[model samples]
Target: MEGQAKGLLKLINEKGIHRNTKFLAIASGKGGVGKTNFAVNLAYILANDFDKKVLLIDADMGMANVHILVNVNTKKTLKDILNGERIEDIIFTTRNFDVLPGFSGIDAINEIDDSAVYKLVQNLNDISENYDFVLIDTSAGIDNKVISFIRASSKTYVLTTPEPTAIMDAYALIKSMKKLYDYSNFKIVVNMVKNEDEGIETFERLRSSIKKFLDIDVQLAGVIPLTKNLQKTVKKKQIISEVYPSDKFVLHLKKIAASEVGEPAPEIKEGFWDRVVSFLRKEG
Candidate 1:
């Protein structure tokens, strides 16, 4: 076992795969928190505003909406890739970034086998290094699928709203994940807030609960205000930073993207791919 571990590490170092791509999984404990919207806009900002190569993978296996919001029509998705299509073949490119769209309303897609998950990661491994950041928009809640993706990411952003239910569910997610995965790198993003104060209060509430029980310190990544324009942009299928560049929400998103929450991309450890493979193996 020791020899095999060393061999795996050696191969990982030699390949140096995914060394330039910083994988960030944008996730939420419950649905309807605008997590997918955040993922899409963040990808656009990173690519257009910061001039970085971004690959936004719509990993919401059950109800994927990234492609819909981005107004990109795709006949093939990550589902096709899972069914033997090359990952490169399924990607749909836009002016902002490349999108690996996921299947929507497909039960089988949601129930992907462990081997298929391994293959999916393996295929992504081939091209992931080409980007500066790979943001995975994950399905809501703390299920096995969600946990698997979050575990593989360099950083996991736990998004939530100010509602008490949302806060509790987000806390529950972190609590559940803490037992099985590393919660140290988890960051909080409070969305749909009236102002920064509300966002901070929500984060503090969730952070206090987590620190009190899990004894894990979670960072406040950013706070997105409740803006009607964001909804309009979603309806129009337009990138917020493009159409409403001067909007407050857009400004906040730009700030978040320019800050450590995004820029000065994190260093990818030499054994990063090895860790991803190990996580998949354990899941399998």
Candidate 2:
């Protein structure tokens, strides 16, 4: 399966590995914020609709679900990579984007060391060089692993809902990450919104809290309204964008892509893996 996945990625990317890949980390303050759902759909749109090569990295560790959302069987995972398997070899190719499935559980996840993190970064950077975009679906909550992934990505998106607890959790995540790197590439996406006005108000509330308390501002990427059809697609293990392209949810996500992800980012001297190494050093 590993070899097959790499071969499939090669077929999609005939030019082989190259630099200039954009790393975008998607996180939720707490679970059930639709973080994985958003990541899967966004990756699908980029690869299937826009005709770009994309890799979706499931960094949720023990609670990986990107494969479940896409209904693909994964015989290998990041655990294999940590045990000396090449990062490129563990990829599980789906219909649209290639998925590097996160491990169900590994003791290392509870006690991962600097060398291990460095190894993951090195291998991820090696394979990520072949794509136009790499979407990291980070684990829920504000653990060290989740924080590390968010801080290392070129862009960070914090997912939230209109619920008060969810809003506070999102603010907490931003505060914790800001203490680490003072990242300016952060954005907010409000999901499961009931209406546009509610979404705007929710974002404004969160933004106000951050500004008044943390003295920093975050951009609102887009709002995804709750739709019954979205759940239907989830049950079917298919991307809502493909099954219901005309949905308001799909339309809003497209707006997010247009915001900045519609094309590859300009090349930079330092790359995603380099950023991870630097972040881990500071984290230590």
Number of the predicted model whose lDDT against the real structure is largest: 2
User: Candidates' TM-scores?
Assistant: 0.85, 0.86
Residue-level lDDT tens digits of model 1 in 14-106: 676435678899888889998988888889888888888889988787788899998988889877867899988899888669999987643
Write down the lDDT that model 2 would get.
0.82
Ten residues in a row with the worst lDDT in model 1? 268-277
Clashing pairs in 2: none
Q: Report the Cα lDDT for residue 138, model 2.
A: 86
Q: Which stretches of candidate 2 lie over 4 Å from their true place?
A: 1-18, 105-120, 262-269, 277-284
> RMSD, each candidate, Å?
6.3, 6.2
Return the TM-score for candidate 2, rounded to 2 decimals.
0.86
Per-residue lDDT for 248 in model 1?
83
